[model samples]
Target: MSTACPSNPRKRDRESSPAEQWRNLARTVPATLMHIGTSSSVKAIRSTKNAKSAMKAAKRSGDLSPAGKPDASGSSWPPEAVELLQQARDDVSIGLKALRDTRDAIVVEFFDAWKVLNQNR
Candidate 1:
């Protein structure tokens, strides 16, 4: 199999140089990687909607017993512990956002380098 670029959009009507063909192929790398990274980073974060629904269902089914927490649960958990858990959850959410931002920044860096390399051409 040929290791050359897969397709040349400019080849339909006119012949294109190898360098141009390779540059076109090179342009796709950063964009594809960024999309993959974004999807992966988004998948790392979990939404509380599902948990809220489950908690509601459990409360209706008499599976949860009240202790004193009315914030998100009816379970017999100490208020201090619940507060700590909520704080941890918030931290995790912020960390996940940072992860996504970092991934996007890496992609932006790559794109910037690409632009610099192709600038004088």
Candidate 2:
């Protein structure tokens, strides 16, 4: 049985060079990781919301601390804590969108890079 060889070995070589592979990865890997991080952050936000809801349910059911204690259901958080959570959510949303945009731009760059490299052949 005979195996078929690539018709254009030089084109294949250029496409699969170590430098080209590295460049492709340099463009792709971080964007993929950032996407994963964004997914995790959104999941965490959902978990936080669920936990808050459960806490409220517990408090209403009288399973929480008595009304007079420091940790009582009636207790309130300082403005700082509330602001911090809000800021974190906002920051994550902004960062995730930015990362998505960056990924899109990188995709365009990849297309352009490949087009240029192919044209050079």
Candidate 3:
């Protein structure tokens, strides 16, 4: 992250600027937690916000829900939050694979049609 956002040192550097020890408490805590056994990252905040905004827009346009209600019944889903999260992840994985397969099929069909036309000519 530091390498990717070299220009945006938004987080206070804890290791660097050793001279700041005198006013360590005065400085805000650095957000470089990824290195310290925590995969929690600052970049995920932006991604979460972006996804929320996109879903909000989709909902408003009636794309996500025409009735503006929950898509599924809670009874059908797992009661535990962890299980629900895993189910959602699996849904996304399956959707992505299906979309990729559809795109590949379309491309193959187009290429095959072009090849047959050339052969006939």
Candidate 4:
């Protein structure tokens, strides 16, 4: 004779598997990157105050060398940082395009539905 308990087995106590963890992280990274990019862009724009103010500051502080040149003496911001900023800008642009497309599609769908309903009536 064989005996088996009817109760369900206890939930497995385990961390996510490596692949699962990686997938989860991958999903989160884009959102985090987008947030960081948007924040940096906002900061950059805000820091400029007005274009005139920024130009004046740069000119007065000698950040711009003679003849309105950017000085090479300062450390270059990391290439990765610049790349990320560009990616963020592109992502935002794509997102806006997607939103517009979706809105247009929905409007068309709604109008089509209304036409169908009117025809049926």
Candidate 5:
């Protein structure tokens, strides 16, 4: 068996410096936040649609047996599902608010740092 060494040394690209990485992260964080906003919007819409459909179905069935109430078992609608849906909405709201706040803070910090750097020059 013979061991062979490669003749050429590969050089890695150094385009991604720390500053560049931070810049990329700053850009990506906002995009990620936007994505989260969109996803939450979609989920909210879907949940609303599902809730409406369930209500319509119940209305159509005319099942007044009280036991026929879709939410009687607390499995799908009456209390648990409603509470869950509300919680989901609240969670998304809080998350978006937090992301927005974080993004604003990052932006302010970046600008302040930039000002300091320029002043030092």
Candidate 6:
């Protein structure tokens, strides 16, 4: 005699193999890494804040050498480079917010996947 599959949609979903469940959950890894990258970039920017401030202060104080050239005695980012760093910091802050929102999304997705995979057991 031929056997029949379960008619319940939920039962069919729960029947997915463990490897399939793992592959489903693995999709969250890239999002997690993006979050980590944002956090690291923010932290790095914060750590350099003092140096950036010092450079700004020096520039404002006319520490430039004759002919309006930067003093060779110390190193600092060029104006364009500084602007780019500022842009990066702004972008990282926005990315961090987005990643924070996605954090909850990933967790809920993982829990749902786990529930589905374990429901049949």
Tens-digit lDDT track of model 4 for 53-95: 4345444544333445433543343344344444555555555
As for lDDT, the candidate ahead, 3 or 5, is 5
Name the runs in model 1 displaced over 4 angstroms: 1-74
Residue ranges of candidate 3 with Cα displaced over 4 Å = 1-79
Clashing pairs in 2: none
lDDT of 6 by residue, 1-121 (tens): 2233677545333455667656866776556656655665566556456446644654654444344655454345356544544655565565565556556666765677668668768
Q: Which tens-of-lDDT digit does each residue in 1-121 have in candidate 1?
A: 1343448655445455656655865786667667767665554543344334444554444433353334454356544445545655665666577577768767776776677557658
Scored by CA lDDT, what does every candidate get? 0.56, 0.55, 0.42, 0.50, 0.55, 0.57
State residue 53's C-alpha deviation in candidate 2, in Å. 1.5
Best by TM-score: 1
**Residue 67's C-alpha lDDT in candidate 1?**
37
> RMSD in angstroms, all models?
7.8, 10.4, 22.2, 16.3, 10.5, 9.7
* Colliding pairs, model 3: none
Name the weakest run of 10 consecutive residues (lDDT summed) in model 2: 65-74
For candidate 2, the lDDT comes to 0.55
How many residue pairs clash in each candidate at the backbone level? 0, 0, 0, 0, 1, 0
Would you give me the overall lDDT of model 4?
Answer: 0.50
Per-candidate TM equals 0.40, 0.37, 0.35, 0.37, 0.38, 0.34
Ranked by lDDT, top first = 6, 1, 5, 2, 4, 3
Model 4, residue 47: C-alpha shift (Å)? 25
